[model samples]
Target chain A: MLHTVNKSPFERNSLDACLGLAKAGSAILLIEDGVVGAIKGTTIESKLTETMQSSKIYVLGPDLAARGLSEDKLVDGIQVVDYGGFVDLAAENTAVQSWL
Target chain B: MSEGTIKKFMYVNRKPPYGTVYALESLEVVLIGAAFDQDVSLAFIGDGVYQITKGQSTSDIGMKNFSPTYNALGDYDITKLYVEQESLTERGLSVDDLMDIVYEDEDDDWAEKPSIRVVSRAELADVIAGQDILLNF
Candidate 1:
């Protein structure tokens, strides 16, 4: 399954909930306010890195741009996906669960 | 407008009702967009599932209680509504908790067809992938 998290991990537990339920090999995409979690050296970075050991992690490139976060600031191993990439991820995964 | 172009438009609703304007705004956009003669579908993910729940009485909240407006979607030729099964499960809701919105199918002797499809996350993902445009709320 593909899990999309659109809430800030600091303000809401939606991202944590998504990370908990997302199974191994699932793809997780961070978009909108959730992009904040993609930053490196943050409290959630370790958790994201840990999850990366099993599943793929992606952040919407445009959302990062909108938030003035450069690709270099994202945690290592996390791929950046454009809107089209977002569509591709949805197509590649079996299912998608959005964490609001 | 292209002479004969009809795109697949999907409205992704992920917010709860009343708390914010996203749900209502998405619905209004869907209704307005229906006039374009395109294949339009709606997906209720996360708290979006709450927007279509039945027996929503906003009398005390001083809200419009626009849940009933979902029924009008069928009349507007907007019938495909995908409700994420996991979102509802986490929220302790079932299909029974949602309004029974239906539309008359012209191809099947006007048979009544249900608009809501309770879909697994994977199934909903497939639906999302097939869309030409995804409007998020």
Candidate 2:
């Protein structure tokens, strides 16, 4: 399954909640304000790094740019994708779970 | 569509309308997704129950009132609308306070049937467990 988290970790615990319920091998795509978690040197950076060990982590490219975050600011190994890539992830996965 | 497999898609609306754009944008996604001919369902829980409340007038708020769009879901063959009973009661709302949404069933000779199903929180949990895809807003 592909889990999309749209809330910022600073505003809510949705990312942690999603990580708790997401199974191994499931993909996590951060969009909207959720891209804040992908920034390097943030408090959640280590948590996101640990999460990538069990599941692939992705951040929406447009959302990142919209927030004025450059690609280099993202944590290592966090893949960035566009809207088409978002659609492709949904099609590739058997299901999608969005954590608002 | 194609002979490809169809997955159960559920849109979970947990926020109220107007205060944020999530509710409206979620509706747009549902409308666009209707073209895929997938098994789609809308689940209203928490503040989401307010989205379908009747007498919604956004004229004073300077925003286009999109509440009526829920009425058009049946036409798109996206008629599985579930309202969590607990959520409504907590907000002091009843089914009577919601919009009257119905669909014409061709199998039943075009007879009109209610599209919204009021379910208990437990029942809604079961419904969530059965969904192949869940889009939360």
Candidate 3:
């Protein structure tokens, strides 16, 4: 399944949605202001990491690089995906759900 | 599974790149989709057009200007990049001032290949209906 999560407030209510829905073969695509969760060392990353422990959760690389967050700034385990990769992921999943 | 049967998604970008991270982040999701061989399209509307303005150098902001990577869309098998015509004029940008990439038009041979389409603001309805899915960034 494909879950499109773009809400910027990932640490609050939305976090649960992201975690609960992600399952084997599922992926979370973080868009919009949600890229803030891409930061590695923050408190939220720990939770995000645990929530997505068995799933593929992606943060837009272009969004991160555009906003000035670099690969170095990204905490461990967070993958910075490029535009091309995003399309491929969307194609692979059987379902695409957006958590606006 | 049939290739064309899958959902093709277009990201509606309406926010500025910095104040909000939607523009950049959405691009990431698109990449993921592409990795899975999905069809993805991108449209810039409102402040999101700010993402492709010319002469964007984010060095002083302590970050890299992502506008250049827009050129790399082809490398990732991502085409169908669209820019709203109304947004261009509102932002004081003419198509001539925009980034150098494939422009999608009905006459173009884009149907034969992965490509980007430049649409007018008025044409968004068609774009919305044409997609199997719609994502707003």
Best by lDDT: 2
How displaced is residue A82 in candidate 2, in Å?
A: 43
Q: After superposition, how far is residue B10 of candidate 2 from its true place, in Å?
A: 0.3
TM-score of 3: 0.50
Over B7-37, each residue of candidate 1 has an lDDT whose tens digit, in order, gives 9999999876665678889989998898888
| Cα lDDT of model 2 by residue, A1-100, tens digit | 9999987675579999999999989899998667757877666778888889989999987655543356876789999998898999999999999999
Q: What TM-score would each prediction reach against the true structure?
A: 0.59, 0.58, 0.50
Write down the worst ten-residue block by lDDT for model 3 chain A: A7-16
Off by over 4 Å in 1: A1-11, A14-100
Q: What TM-score would chain B of candidate 2 score versus the native chain B?
A: 0.97
Candidate ranking under DockQ, highest first, comes to 3, 1, 2
Once model 2 is optimally superposed onto the true structure by TM-score, how far is the C-alpha of residue A23 displaced, in angstroms? 48
Error of 1 at A87 (Å): 48
Taking every candidate in turn, the Cα RMSD to the unseen true structure, in Å, is: 15.8, 15.4, 15.7
- The per-model DockQ list reads 0.02, 0.02, 0.05
lDDT of 2 by residue, B1-137 (tens): 77889999999998666656888999999999999999999999876776787666554335677888898998999878999998766544578868888988988898999999999999999999999999999
Candidate 2 — which pairs collide? none
